[model samples]
Target: MNLETHEPVAENLGVLEIAALLRELTAALLDIADFDEALTRLVTVAQRTVPGVTWCGFTALRAGEPAGVAASDPRLAELDDLGHGAESPAMSAVHRREMVLSTDLAAEERWPDWTARACALGVRSVVAAPVDIDDHVIGALNLYADAPDALTARRQLTAMLLAEHAGLLLAGVRGREQRTALTNEIDETLLQEGVIGQAIGVIMTQRGCPAPEALQVLRSAALALSIPLREVAERLVVTVSRSRGA
Candidate 1:
């Protein structure tokens, strides 16, 4: 965490610039870090004010995985298979160093792992715009939708308008160690670790399955539903509670 932790940098705001709201968002992006509080704030504004955006989120390339950098939508469950390649469109964009537009996840047909997961979670389409600096792609802005055609040519025009601002912000904010520290909480914070370890033990004892098998069951349900494993855990706990009338 040696890098700057999203302290404010801009002060002069009296003069109103002549540009669209999205353009202004892009301009402000220059001051945000990869995991900065400003980044989350931007998502909030996008969800609240930006048109044609139902869900707004950002993901950064981390050791070839698309890590959830930030998000504004609550429907978006936390992704678990971020580390799995071929299941990550955002990571693929970083590899190709290009943006990806999915007009229809069912019709376009690519990246089964990612698409299947998205479809299971009710994501009909997506637009993944690359976050590049200098020349290398670092991460992506993923806009999910319930329709086939979510973004139009005008939207890209608007997104690119903002991307330029974001690029500068990302380049200035991104660092290996800092990003690592933020992403290192997956195993420890989620799944059979800490609080979850005790829960898994209960499941194993009740279901007569080994700990490994119980864990496998969780992963399988997540894969089947194309949702995060945590969501499955929440459901299991709820189901047991209801059965016991708790």
Candidate 2:
């Protein structure tokens, strides 16, 4: 994050205005229940709020590979395909961990082929900002415009701020997902423990075997069946219950 660009976003969007927009975006992002949904909503918000942005999308990388994309319009996803064989402006932003601005795509010297493709789509200007989380660039937010020089300095600064916020929100969503998965794993372990304990008790009562010995029997059965210990315990308990009823 550059301190020079870190000042107020835009004079047109005063402190109060930017603050209100941030609050709204934050609330909406927090309400998202899944990571994929959050990514989609992040670009949607950028397209709606940023001036002269005709389209918005994001390209995420993992282990230096292009992983996935989320765009406001499905057709805009073609931008990510450009990232595969050649270095488009968006991937360059992600790799360099900085913003890449092409005020006029027609004269983009570095990526002439990509510029020609984008021109065919009626895109004349583009601005991409690295979605940095904890100083690591995970993705880039790509904004496109139909007219040249549409993303002015002030607008670019505003887009950068929004991209930063999206990164934070994405990190938070990932954290929540990991925590939930861990909790579910713990719950499953507890349920398996209870089932195995009940099966051990049944074995002890029926065969007068010690608890450890009964547990060993259950483990042997699991190994023989090539199944989980919990499945073996469940089958044993069910069989015992049925025999008692009969």
- Enumerate clash totals for all models, in the order shown: 0, 0
Question: Any idea what lDDT model 2 has?
Answer: 0.77
On a 0 to 1 TM-score scale, where does candidate 2 land against the true structure?
A: 0.71
What is the alpha-carbon lDDT of model 1 when measured against the actual structure? 0.60
Q: Taking the tens digit of each residue's C-alpha lDDT, what string does model 2 give over 55-170?
A: 99888776676666888888767875545455787777876778888999888897777777789888899988888643332888899999998887677877777888888988
Q: Indicate the worst ten consecutive residues by lDDT in candidate 1.
A: 1-10
Candidate 1 lDDT, 1-246, residue by residue in tens: 011113232331112331556565656555554455655755665555545666777666555445446777655634223554445656555566666677778876668777877787778877666676433335666666777776654554445445555666556555533565665554445444643565566578789987667776777888999998777777777777688895
The most accurate candidate by TM-score is: 2
